[model samples]
Target: MTAIILAGGKSRRMGFNKAFLPYGDKTFIEHQIARLNKIFDEIILSANDARLYAHLNLPIVSDILPERGPLSGICAGLIRSTSFHSFVIACDMPFIHEKIILYLREQIGGYDVVVPQTSRGLEPLHAFYSRNCIQPMYRCLNEGRLRIIDFFSEVKVKIVDEQEFKELDVPTQPLVNLNTPEEYQKYCDYKAPNQRES
Candidate 1:
C-alpha cells in the first residue's frame, strides 16, 4: 500500500516547518519517510511547497484544493493513490511508532477510515483511508465543510483502541507533536545527547 504524508502545515507556533526539526541524525520527516518506505510500496508527499521533501526523490503532490488543511491533503492523496488503502500521517507528529502503523494497516480492511482513539479524541492524521472517501470528501470540500473528522459518520470508520496503540508505547506519546521551540529543543536533547547523532 501507499503512504501519503501531509506536509503543508503552516507551523504558526513553531516558526518553521515541523518536518525540518532534527531528530536523531535526520529531520523528522526524513526519519518518518525512511521508516515508512520500509513497509509501504510507494510514498506520496502532499504539500504546497515542493522545496520540502524534494531531496528525498519520492513522488510529491500539492493539495487539489489548497489552503484547506489536512482534510484537503487527504482528499488529494485518496485521488492520487493506486492502493485501495492509503496510510496518512501528519508532518508534525514526531513519535508515531511503526508498530502501531503496522497494526493500523492490518485493521484497514473493510473500513473507509482506520484511526486510533486516544483519551482526547481520534488521531486522524495517523490513520488509514480507503478510496471510497473520494466522493464524500469532494462533497465535503465543495460544501465548505473542511473539518477532517466531520465525515466520519458518512463512512465505515474503525477506531483502533488503546490495546493496539499500547504496542507502540503509545499512551506515553500517542501523538507527540512539537509546537514550540522549547519542546523541540527538549526532543533534540533527548534524541541526541552530547550533540552526538543517533
Candidate 2:
C-alpha cells in the first residue's frame, strides 16, 4: 500500500504553514517521510505548493480540485496511488504512531475505508482509503459537499473503535496536530523533557 501525506491545507487557523514546523531534527514533512517510509514502499505527497516540497524527493501531486479541502486531496492521492489502498494523513500530525498505521493496513481488506473512530469523531485524515472511494469522493466534491466524511454512506467503511486506537496510541493523545501556535508550542515543550532525557 502507498502512504499519502496531505500537505495542502491553507493553515488559516495556524497563521503559518505547519508543514515546515520542526519536529525532531528535521522539518515536519521530513520527519513524517522518515517514519512512513518504514511501512510503505510508495509514499506520495499531496500538496499545492510543489516547489516548497521538491526537496523531499518524493512524487508530489497537487489536489485535483484545489481549495476544496482534504476531501479533494484524498481523492487526488487515491487516483495516483499504485496500490488499491492508501494510508492518508495530514502533515501537521507529528505523533502519528507506526503501529497504528500497520494495524490500519492490516484491516483494509473487505472495506473501502478503514478509519479510526474516537469519541470525538472520525479521524478521516488519519485513515486508510481504497481506490474504490475515488468516484464517490468526486461526486461529493462536485456536489460542493466538502466535509471529509460526507460520502461515507456510499462506501463500505470499517470504523476502528477508540479502544483499538488507545492500545496503539496510549493515553489517546487526541492525534495531536499543530494547527495553532499554542498547540505547536505545547508539542515542542512536551517533547523537550523527553529529548533532554534521551
User: Candidate 2: where is the Cα deviation over 4 Å?
Assistant: 169-171, 190-198
Residue 7's lDDT within candidate 1 is: 90
Q: lDDT tens string, model 1, 1-198? A: 999988988999999888888777788888778778778999999988988678889788888787777888889988889898999988877665667778888887789899888776788888899988888887888888999888888999999876665565544353566778888876654431212333
Candidate that would win on lDDT: 2
Backbone clash pairs for candidate 1 read none
Consecutive 10-residue window with the lowest summed lDDT within model 2:
189-198
Q: Model 1: residues >4 Å from true position, as ranges?
A: 167-174, 189-198
Q: After superposition, how far is residue 95 of candidate 1 from its true place, in Å?
A: 1.9
Residue-by-residue lDDT tens digits, candidate 2, 38-58: 789899999998999998899
Work out the TM-score per prediction.
0.89, 0.92
lDDT accuracy of residue 115 in candidate 2 = 91
